[model samples]
Target: MGKLLTLAKEIIFPSRTTCFICGREEIVGEDDLCDACRESIHLCICPPAPLPLDGVSAGLLYTKELHEPMHRFKYRDKVEYAAFFCQYMSIPQDWSIDILCPVPLYYLREMKRTYNQSELLARRISAIYQIPYCRDLLEKTRNTATQTRLNPAQRQRNVQNAFKAAPECKNLSVLLIDDVYTTGATLASCAKELKKQGASKVYALCACKTDN
Candidate 1:
């Protein structure tokens, strides 16, 4: 009876067994990508960390193939997609991160969305890597314009003074988690606030990075 009930549930609301990238049902791996789509994913070979970030890494290069799914994950309530994305994020051996801090969304924005996508990624990463995560440590204080259409300098200005860090961040090494790394503007702004609150080091990890 239990098996029959479970099978009914599967039939009613299908599980995410299909490849997230190509929607292929054939032998999808644990990351939710079939062999062909998985091979097509371009891993990010990051350059040196920009100012204020001690280190940085990302899982995939943000290609056109990934854009649709990523948009859905962020804006279309595809929250379950966090599990598939976090599987590819790896923490570097050198950074002694004390806590995972998701780059925050403005309270109103989060309230409207019902969840912060970055926080979802951070929680999954913390569970997988056995590292603690603290959403209270950093906060978005301002509802800045979205960085999507902004140029590099404009992106920097948009997030300036947009975040505040808790005093508890003092002396701790923090790893900032976000869905994408584009201009490094948002992460750097968040890192600056953390440092001002006395954080010793800051690093960043993202699900994807634009190939620009």
Candidate 2:
């Protein structure tokens, strides 16, 4: 089964000879990004966490150059992009996380998308670090509006009370996974619910974050 799964990943996410971002047939690195892309995609420097979150970290600073690719990864069924994004998602050494919990989509939205992009990211990171991930630890109870066009205050209102935590989360230090962190309203809301359910700590890790 392991061999089969490996073969399937190779077949589905096939090795890229060119940069996945620019489609340049340059020397792509292990993450499948060429030198130019690797350089242009800036690393996210110590992003601050909002209330209810113990800490937050991100792989890259979300720039205009990344918008289309990130959009495709989340909405266009480019599930394989999770592998590429996971290459940069590093866990901080001091987090002391016990498990990963993905920020979920509402059931109806997930049914339409067929998968939550955050869940895909968390699963890959779990495999890489040998840490367990639990999708059932948190849930999206409301189908909220997209946070893309909203202002920070509006974003906060959009996701407020949208999440619920499971009893199993009690006392566990969790790291929340998502594709991107913008304003952090959504993550903070999720973290708040987790803590209310007795989570010892709730940190967030995203593939990227808005440079703001």
Q: List the residue pairs that clash in candidate 2.
A: none
Task: Indicate the TM-score of model 1.
Answer: 0.89
Tens-place lDDT digits, model 1, residues 41-111 = 98888878778999889988999889989999999999999987887789989889999999999999999
What is the lDDT of every predicted structure here?
Answer: 0.92, 0.92
Worst 10 residues of 1 by lDDT: 23-32
Q: Candidate 2: lDDT over CA atoms?
A: 0.92
Model 2 bad stretches (over 4 Å)? 1-16
